[model samples]
Target chain A: MITIELNGQQQPLPTGSTVSDLLSTIGSDGKSVAVLVNQQIIRPENRPTLMLQEGDQVELLIFAGGG
Target chain B: MDLLQLGSHSFSSRLILGTGKFSNAAVMLQAVRASGAQLVTVALRRFNREQAEDDLFGPLSTIEGVTLMPNTSGASTAAEAVRAAHISRELSGSAFIKVEIHPNPQHLMPDPIETFEAARILAKEGFLVMPYITADPVLAKRLEEVGCAAVMPLGSAIGSGQGLANAAMIELIIRESSIPVIVDAGLRSPSEAAHAMEMGCGAVLVNSAVAVAGNPPEMAEAFAEAVAAGRKAFRAGLMQKSGSAIATSPLTAFLGATL
Candidate 1:
């Protein structure tokens, strides 16, 4: 199992899951958003294929029209 | 020149100036006037309560008809950015915001996740969100889809004066984006600003470049001229590139053969 932090909350994911897998499991809405793994921005193309490691911290930010 | 429409505000000048790093308020005001920039960026922070008079706000407040774009310069989190935006609204009475979330002070690189998160919240709250981000095409599209007035992508690291480090990415952003793409940060000279405009950017935000110059007013005028020239060039349409060099000599000439 791998531990990840989403917006500061720690959660566990299935072992050997990638960031894409984790995003899918969490049911992201696919809006205009950015993902950071261990404080480094993960490019969109690499998001789906990049594998996750144990104790990895992930933060996903969604940019939406607010005003 | 096409007016830059940010939220409800429309500005004719594409050069956005920042109110920082100036030697004094007079110089700042003079520089701003010379630049002909309608939108000016100001940082939101606590003023020294002990001081009898704060000079920073006075000079900025006196500038007539210029829209004050308050930035969350020190904020590192979404919540902080949001709070800073609100404070700016109260202080300036304008919904215009430059959402900046830089957790790392050393490089001042924006935290993309935090910036996006803050942008979403701020936009939802009815603030004109203009995020300063890295030259990431995906991020630019994401920001646009979320209702940002414009996306301000940096030419290089903030204050580094490293001009247009991510040229390809910036070009991609300009090509794909429907809204304005303002090249912001790391611009050290008027030429850099002009280059950004020539690359089809809607505008360029400059601060350190003008402020740090030996003569701020002269530098500001130079930038204004450069921006104008660049915009004119862009509107005039740049020449198309050719992949391979073409020979002037025709095939018939070669066949007729003079050696």
Candidate 2:
């Protein structure tokens, strides 16, 4: 298992897990969420092939209410 | 129709509603429908699985004729705001971005320097930038020159419900700006929104005023009506002020005395 920073929190993921696996582990369908890995946007197509590495700073963003 | 033109997009409704501070998502959605606002503002947040219901993209999109203008609220710098704009464009598939860069939470006053920088960059990048700013004519004109679709000057403070505290300065902004001058904050009631419109503001962006009302939907409808009436009054032109009373009826005395 490797530790990856998810939304500023440390999370352990299986070695060589793709971004899709991470989304699955977190129960996210990746439909309405924007995923960023190491400050780079991880597109939906790239999420399936891109593997997560140790200390990868992953940030998920969603639209919320604001003025 | 006097459409509210922002860049290439046009909207019949001038009431811009902010998707915040509502009691619940359901109520917020209902208020949105009642407001008749074609242009709505939203914000980006870190995804929280525990509070997934807070996500408004899908729910807000369900409303007909509503266009999303996602705001860069949390960003404190120009670079952060630009980055947020890119991400929001990707998710929302819209070119409208509200460059809101207020570093201090206490006052929530926009930093003119940073906002100017962000608006310049975003406008150059082909995004329709709507910058939230102070009631400064110089700053508002600067933003317009930088290709901003509109300048949203606060009436007072955010959520204060002060109702046009800086009316004098806002009037100056409206006078000098070629782009739309929108009153974004510090409004408490529909009457305030109407007053802002009557002062020649292209539109008014309201959130706390309707969100905290007794009945959010009913208040939203009232604001919609007020905005329409004010816009019509402005277009028709208001009567000028007079120093003394001007008699509407004929002044000639004919009943009992000679003319």
Candidate with the greatest TM-score versus the true structure? 2
lDDT (C-alpha, whole model) for all candidates = 0.80, 0.94
Model 2 ranges off by over 4 Å: none
Per-residue accuracy of model 1 over B1-259 as CA lDDT, tens digit each? 3887787778889899987778766788899899888888877433222431333445566778787888888799999898777656755667889999999988999999999999988888889999999999999999998889999999998778898888889999999999899999989888888889999999999988888899999999999999989988999999878899866676566656766
Candidate 1: pairs in clash: A65-B146, A66-B123, A66-B124, A67-B123, A67-B126
Q: Provide the TM-score for each candidate, comma-separated.
A: 0.74, 0.97
* DockQ for every prediction shown: 0.01, 0.87
Angstrom error at residue B132, model 2: 0.5
Which 10-residue window in model 2 chain B sums to the lowest lDDT? B250-259
Q: Share of real contacts kept by model 1?
A: 0.00
TM-score of chain B of each: 0.92, 0.98
Chain B alone, model 1: TM-score?
0.92
**Per-residue C-alpha lDDT of model 2 across residues B1-259, encoded as one tens digit per residue:** 7999999898899999998999999999999999999989999999998998999998999999999999999999999999999999888889999999999999999999999999999999999999999999999999999899999999999999999999999999999989899999999998999999999999999999999999999999999999999999999999999999999999776876853
